[model samples]
Target: MSSSSSSSFIIRIFIICGTIFNLSHQIKTIDALQPMKSSSLFIVFGRPGSGKTTVANKAFESLSLDNNKNNKHQQCIELDLDVCISQEMKDNFGRGIYPSLKERNVFASGACDYVEKQLDEKLLKCQQQKQQQKDFNLSAIISFSFVNTDLRDIFRERFPKAEWILIDTTEEECTKRINEREGHFYKGDTPDKKKKEEEVDTTTNEEKDMSDWEFNPVTFPHIILDGNDPIEDNANNVVKEILGKNEEI
Candidate 1:
């Protein structure tokens, strides 16, 4: 080959190699600038007496066991809104204070505020560790009766990426469960009366209580489990989903 042609071929190869190197470096730099996500928050919610507490407790236990088995640095934590609210009432009013049904929402709002503060602190610590290039992973499972869009929005705004699980049950089943409940104050609004209709069915008090409680398809999508299912089965399903999400991190 002529010297002129050989020189042109060598110059083309050099240009191609240099372009590839520059692109690779740019990709690496972009990746390094992105922060690592080391935290996961899971919200378990449903109507009152939907068996959310039982399933959430069992799921938390399973996740804790899995974390221990894997020797993961990630901490698994469970937060029950009812328990927190009860503690707050006891601390303020006294141990004998019957959780007032009328004041429940007020107390619940306060409890949510407390949890939000605690979460903010935990996230701040995670961020500090992240800046140092150290891992500080956390997994929190929260149980609550997020009966309305407003209540659910509190967490949705805080943790946009949070995963949600819903325990779904019929209104009749929920009333039956509430009737049998011994400790909780929220007995169904009309525990004794059963409403029926001859032609057009009207909304009952149970329906009214659950009027605003709905799963938003767009704003709040969730993994749903049957409330009638055995606790063990529901718990296993939750744990499976949680593990699957964690794997993505």
Candidate 2:
């Protein structure tokens, strides 16, 4: 065979071998992770504008179960509570919901309810299907600020093997980010809407018990990730850290 043809043949062989290796790895991982071994609740905790979403998006993309026949829906699904709440608000009300920075407690209370519901539903399904180890594949990555210990414990109970990540940035930087950020629910496109959203009492606490989680001083033990760096770089580094940790599994 010609050298070029030989090279092409070798490449095809490599691809086929890689596929087999990937399948083997998937099965091995599934067996090892029986009863949700590969499972972990990656907590992206930070005040607004600390690049929580960016790192989260990157982590979701980077982490995944190896390709297997029963793993079509396999992925690191992000339960971004902020987006979920905005969506929830839109569903209940006729328009979008935008809570001010100070009204974070209201947002958190609503989001916690929604997050718990999601966990209950997903975990129920997982428990029901735990016997099917061959098809076992599900992991939830929640991106939210666990400003208090109670909220953190709630998720921890549902997902015992939780991973904590706190994006460290000053409030001054977060304020600057709040002003510069666009397409945010609270950070409206038009000046008028922005002013209105920024104004207090625009979002009613229908239930007064929705006190803020920030009052809880206890923060979960977390890996401090630098949020000041370029988003992509920061994301890639966070992926490296997570993947590095999972290399043993």
* lDDT (tens digit, per residue) of candidate 2 on 198-231: 7775435743234332334445566877778777
1-249 per-residue lDDT for model 1 (tens digits): 999999999999999999999999999866655444456888888888899989989999888887768645565678887766565554433222234334455655676676666665665564545422244466778898876565666567657788999888877898799779886755455312222223365767755444333433335578888999999999999888877786677
Q: How far out, in Å, is residue 68 in model 2?
A: 9.0
lDDT, model 1, position 204? 77
Point out the worst 10-residue segment of candidate 1 by lDDT: 190-199
Task: Return the lDDT, model 2, position 16.
Answer: 100
Give the Cα lDDT of each candidate: 0.69, 0.60
Positional deviation of residue 57's Cα in model 1 after best superposition, in angstroms: 0.4
Listed in order, each prediction's TM-score against the native is 0.61, 0.53
